[model samples]
Each structure stands twice: as C-alpha cells, then as structure tokens.
Target: MYRTWRFATGCNDACAIDDYRDICPVFFFGGIHSKKGFFMGIVRKPSVTPPSSRSPVDATPSRTRPGSATFGDGPAVKIFRPDTDQAQVEVPRQSAAADSMITVSSMPSAQILPMHPMAGSLARYSLRAPANLPAANALGLRVFKSRNYVDIAPGEIVLVRETGTAGEYRAALVSELVALGPVLFYHPLSKTWTLERPHPLPEPGKVIDIDIDQLVRKVRKEHAQKHRVHTGNDDSFEYSAAQEGALVARGLKQFPPEQAAIIRSELQAVESIFADAGHAIGQNYKDADAVYESFFGVDHHAVAQRFADSVARGQALSSEYQGTWGDEKFVGVDADSNSAAWMYKRDFHGRFFINRKYMQRGVLSISLGHEMLHTNRIDRFQTIGPNAADYFYLDSRLGRLLNWDTLADYDVPERSVSDAIMRGGLTVEYLNAFTNDHDNFLFGVSDYLGIGDDLPLQTAVDLFNANPSLRAHLAVNNADSLVYAAKSMQTLHQSKTEYAWLDSLIDD
Candidate 1:
C-alpha cells in the first residue's frame, strides 16, 4: 500500500511521501495526532465540526511563494504546521492521490520562498461559489458554526467569483461571515442584509486579483442593462412620471381629496423610507436608482397595474380578478382584517393589495406602507435572531412549522397565565413571531417613521404598561407594537433586552 513519490523541485523535503491513501483536495504532511482527530482526506461539508486544536500535521513549518506549482494550474495546498498557523505548502497537481497510503518523512533542505504577507491577506479575502444555483444549494459550505471563514469582518469588501466561469467577478460588501462558511453580502442599495447572498471560499489558487476598475465597470454594466430594460420597447411596462400622475388621479377620482392625499402621502413616505435606508448605508445611488426603479419596471404584470387602476376607480371587489402577479411575485390582501398587514419575500410577489373596505387614512397608511415594502422588494431578512439561543429556537422542531396560523392566540387568557408563571415572559416567542409576517419585523421602524401613529400598536403599548392582564393580548395580538415598545424600553431605560437584536434588523 506504500509508494514512494518524488515531489517536484521546490517542495520541502518533508513532502516526500512514502505512502498515500485517501488524501484529496489538499494533502497533510503530518498524520492524525489521535484516533479522535479527523483526516484531511475527507472532503467536508460545512457545519460538520470545528477545526481541531490538536496538530494533525508536523510541528515544523514550511514556506512557499503564493503561486501555482509548475505541475498544474491548480493553486498550492496549505498544510497546517503545529508551530505556526496555516503554513504554506505546494504539491504537484498529478501527485495528489486520494487512495494511496501517506507516510510522513523527514524534511530535506530546499529553497524556501519568502511568503508575501499582503498578498496572502488579499487571497484570504477572495471567495468563490457555484454560479447560477438556488440560494440554498449555491451556498453548500458550512456557515452556521465552522472555522473556514476569512479574516474579513462584516461591512468589509471582498472579491468574489462564481464557479464554472472565468474572469467574471463581483466586488461584494460583506454583511456577515456566519459561523465559518458561506459568506453573506449586502446589495449596494439594501438597507439590511435581508437580501444576503452567500458565497463559499475559492478552491486553491483561485483567489481573485482585486481590480477596482473592473468592479466599477461591472456595476456600470448592470446599471445600463437595467436601464435598458426599464426604458425598453414594451410600452405597457412604463412607470414614468405621467403614469405616476395618472395613477394618483384615478385614486383621487374615486376617493375624497383628503383621503386620496393621505394615500399619496403614504406612497411618498414609502419612497422616502427606501431612499433613506440606502443613503444611510452609503449606497451608490447612481447605480441603485436603476435597480430600485426596475423593481416596478416594465416587466411588472399588467394585471398589477390594472388592479391598482381598479382600486383607484372604486371597483376593488369587482375588479377583474388580478389573475396572477406571475412566478416572481406574490400579491394578496389580508382576509381577516385591514388591521393585520404583512409583507416579505418568500417565493415572490408583486403589487400591493389595498383593502378598499378600510379607507381610513391611518389604517390605509400602515397597510399600504407595509405592502409597499414587499412591492419594492425591501422586506426583512429571514433568521430567528442574533443569539445562539435564538438560532437554536429557529432551528428547533417548532420553528419550522411556525406561521401566522400555527402561532399562539393573542387573547388566550389561560395560556398567558401559564406562560407567565412558567416562562417569566413571552419575549422570545413574540420576538421570533415575525418569520411568516416580515412586516412585523420592521414595525418598530414604521413606528419611528410614524406610519401607524393612530393604530392599535401605541394603544397596545399603553395597555401593556397599565395592566398585566392586557400584556399577553398585546404581546401576541399587537405583536408589532411589542417590537416598537421593545425599542422604546431600550432607548428610554437603556436596558439590554432580547429585542436589542432588532437594531441589526432596522433600516436605520
């Protein structure tokens, strides 16, 4: 089972392998330290286990320049040296055998190239992932709790490339490096990392050479392509200034001027929300403007426009069933009441559905504002919470089935009493309830903007303060109010509450 192989010149004498078995992707000079330690031969999926502290390789360090070995185009493999962290080593491409036994040998004197610290740092920042795959499948790397992460922090920059393509790249702004794998990045115009796209580390020697000009060119190209689509030949797709005025006029023709004005103000406020969030994050507005407009661009379903027109004409119920908003969008109204408004990206949907029955300015503003977030594709991200406990709660058996329907009833007196006595409070349950209803995630944000000033949220908060009996109802029924109140309590009392994580969720 042992075969002696001569490593190409420049390899350290330690790399002389007398036996090789199941060594793949990369090779390890030192064998396993103990039976409990895993072998490098096993190509791992993300989140399987943490990197072992015990030395799996020899304690002696080696150095090599950051370049491909003469044998093949593949990048050099890194070996772990016990004395130093991530000692650099290279292997001849053809010498990498996955089925041969590997026996460690003594080091022989050879030329040791000096490591480029800056170049190595940049290489670590580079990421690569499979291209043109679903978000879930694309990020197959262990991210929850692995140690494969780069040194880059959240809000830092990194160069990324997709697998199966060469020379194409994206300059990403990292939102987070979750656990240890699948890097999450923010869109230039996004308020939060709700639209986070995860990327895996590059396969050896595949680190991207950062080029500022190339990245700028790619962004500009995206802007141009989006602009072309927006102003393209399809006249029906137009959402021009004329269309905006006409859409407003139709609403005014149907409702009283005062009511219509309020609706108009709400729509404007929604735009302001989108604008402010992007600006606060230092978004590239020149490029982002096109991306934002394309959210309502010509490709929008004609039925969506017709539905809006019908609502404006006071023919909501009788309006030709808005057919479908197509595969990319989800459009619906709250069946129970206008009091309950929610919106988020889940499958997909377009065009906000207005409940014509409740035309009050305050009610309409909240509903419209909430749905508008969805329509504009600016909804909240899906995650249980920021803490380990919250993530565990979400990954639990109950979290998977949690929807608005599966949720505990807001007004259940007996359950409230039991929960209070046993659990102290319902903070965690209520905090995590926004999974199905993303609009509730930003309720505190909307409150800050005065979107639902006259709604039950404020009243619910007052009730929560005044009576213990009322707390349970407000906690579940006025769930959004609870978020707002959480923010208020933290701000006024400077308390470290469960909802402090909401600061990461809010747009500003």
Candidate 2:
C-alpha cells in the first residue's frame, strides 16, 4: 500500500506534508509498504542541513532505509524533531536590494548633511558610489588640479578640496580632458570657481597684448598738442621780441651813427690782420664765428659774411694808420658799460678791450697801439715792475710837447729812453729817503690814488705783494715802502690831472 501524511497549522489548512517508503524511515514525496508487516508507509522526522555544511545539493531519492521493523498497528508513528534546527530554516532574511532601500531612507541626503552651506554647494555634483563617497567627503570642498581625477569623465562634476591646513572648498565641472587633466569651469567675473566650493584659485585668462610702438606714437601726438597750446599766445612772442629789441636799442644809443659806422669798419680790418698773421698762427674763420655767435647771437654763415665785409673795410683803415699814432692788430670793444678797458695775455697772444662808450676809431686805434707797445716791452725786458718808472718819467719830461713825435724814435734805441728817464730826476737819495718813511704815505696815497676803494686798501696791498712779478716793480729800489709810497703818490696825482683834463675838454 502507499500512503501520505498531512501537517496542518492552527488555521486548519494543510500547510506542509510528507510521504515515506515502506521498510524504511526516510521521507519522500511518495510512500511504499514493505513485507515485514502490513506495510502502510514509512514515518521520518523533518530536519534541515547544518548551517555550516549547507550547500547546493540534488533532491533525488536515495535507497538507504532506517532499521525500524514491526510496523503493524502502532497507532501511526509520529516523528520527533528539534524545533531549533527547524527554526533556522523557517526564517527568511532580507535581500541586498531591500537593505539598500532601507539605508537610503534612514541616511540624510548630502544637501541636508550637517555642513556649511558653501560646502553643500561645492559637493552638489560630487556624489558617488559608496566606495568612493568616503574619499570624496574626506576631500571636502576645495580647489584642486582637474588632472588629479584621471578617471573622471568629461562633463562630469567633481569635488576638489584643497589639500592644505588652511581648509578651502570648491566644486567644479570637468569641461575638457586635456593632456594635463580635466579642465574645470572657472568664472572670471566672480574670480572664483563655478564648482560649489569656497577657495582661492590662480588668476585666470591670458594677459592682453599691447603694441608699444603704437602707444608711443599716440603719446607723442598728445605731447605735441600740449606744446602748441602752451606757446600759442601772440603776447608771449611780442613780449620776448620787444625785450630783445630794447636791449639792442640801448646798445645802439651809446654810439653816434658815424662812430658806429667807424667801429664796423674797424672790425672789418681785423680779417686782413689775421690773414697777414697766416692761417697757422692767426685767428681763423672759426674764431670769427665764435665772436659773432657769442656777441650777436648770429648763425655761423651770417657771421662769416658780416666778418668778411668788416675785414674789407678794416684793411683800408689799417693801411691808413699803419705808420701813424693809431695801429694795432686786434681790439675788443666792451659793449657793456660797467666794465673797464683791459688787456690780458694768453699762451698764443695778447688781447685788448676798449670800453665801447669811451672809444671811437681814433681813440681805439691809439689805445690799442699803446697796449701793443706794452706787450712788446713785456716781451723784450722780460722784467716787470716800478724800475721802469724812471724811463716813463724821463720820456714824459723830454717828450713834453713832442711826445707823439718821438715814440718811434725812442723805440730805435730802447736804452735811450731808459737813460733819459733816469737823468730827468730819479736819484738814489730820493729813493732811499722815501723807502725809510713811506708806509703811512703809501696807504694814504693809495686811497687818494683810487687803485681800489679805500675800504679794500689792505686787500689791494696784499694782492699786489702776493704776485712776485707785480711786487718786483714796486720794490725794485730795495726800499719797498718808498717805492709803494712813490707809486701811490704818482698814481693819485696822475689820476687827478687826467680827470681835470677830461672835465675841461668835455666842458669845452
């Protein structure tokens, strides 16, 4: 016979059932009897495989049977089983999907996560798989090189937290994949990253190129305009021209037209004098140029032309006075009134200046001739000082009314002039007597002589004595005090006489 048994829950519905084979206690889906007794079915207890040993196994029936015999009328054998073992198989665990669903509900979204608002914005696109999420969180919001995320795809968003102790935050979108790395979206207007993070970044954009030459030209144009505006006024030009004209007018007033003409003519004569001296040793066109530029503010070409004209006229005048009282190669007219006539020596030659107001052509030539004589004597005697005073005195006494007549004659025998002056009245007794008592006389007479102002008398004395050349002239008598006193007295008397004579002539 074959039999089956049913198991029921408390609700009275068949829940689970089993059948067994006869002459064995093993359970199966079907049952069979054995010959040992009136075989109805085999009874077996339900059991689960051990948890540690459970694995995939086939459910095919096995031939092995339990050793239980005498199965007749045993009131339907019921199997005994451990509920602990049974319970292990009865309970079903949740699936992985179910676990994930639960986790998503329980955990907060990154938006609601306890973080700074800026940090939230920075992490907006940074969500990732569970495995990567921890690392992204650790990075926080910060600036980073886009290339750092080599695995990141283009157009994907990332969280880049600066790796520094200062803790900055930023979020970025990968816009491009370059050799270096993914380029992030950075906004220049805000000077920050579009990535939802707060952090400082490198300056953006290339520096604009500029053309320096174009800029220079623009600046020059502006400068020229400014210059034009500054110099625009007619009043300024007129004022400057008038000032120069006034100075020239005042200079012209000092000389009558005829005298001015004569001066021009005389300047012309210097060219021939320079020519006669030769190009090697005389003044050149360059010297003429310098003089014209310095005095007249004229160009070199104009100066040369004016100088040539002046020279033509000057040569004629020079010839006329060559053997007369007026003859000299060079003369300078001092156009300024404050300065006096002077003579100076340079390495190559001597120069003479005649006060323009005090000298006409005649006076200029005569004065120049006198200065040239002094130069010649200086060159000859090689001696300088008051020893020559005797010669002057003798010449003055002898020449009296014939002074001009005898100048050239005296030059013939230079010694004759010397002898004449000594014989005329310079005695050794007079020299010695004066030397002994002349300090007060010298000082007093020097003041009256106007060698310099009385207030600077001592300075004048010091200056005269300081120069060995000048000192020798006044001290030649071996009686310095006497020589000084005599000179001072003679100078004072001569100045007075000249002044009186000039006054009378001017009055006449």
Backbone clashes in model 1:
16
Q: Give the TM-score of candidate 1.
A: 0.21
Relative to the unseen true structure, what is the C-alpha lDDT of residue 240 in candidate 2, on a scale of 0 to 100? 24
TM-score to true structure, per model: 0.21, 0.17
Q: Across residues 88-150, which tens digit of lDDT does each residue of candidate 2 receive?
A: 001123587797664432222222123334333333244222222222222322212332221
Model 2 Cα shift for residue 199 (angstroms): 89
- Candidate 1 residues 1-508, lDDT tens each? 0001112222343222211111101111132100001111112222112222212233222212124321132122211111112221122122446336665343321122232342232332333321211122233221212222221222222333332334223222233212111233433332212213434445799986666666997986698567632212222211221211122222133445565565556544433332233222232223322221221222223222222221121111111111211111111222322112222111122223232333444334323322222111211222111000000011112222322233232221222222231122223343222111112222322333445423343343333334443332223222122112212222222222345578567946
Candidate 2 — which residues are off by over 4 angstroms? 1-340, 347-349, 374-419, 422-424, 427-508
Tell me the whole-model lDDT of each prediction, alpha carbons only: 0.25, 0.27
lDDT, candidate 2, equals: 0.27
The RMSD (Cα, Å) of candidate 1 is 30.2
Best-performing candidate as measured by lDDT: 2
RMSD of 2: 66.7
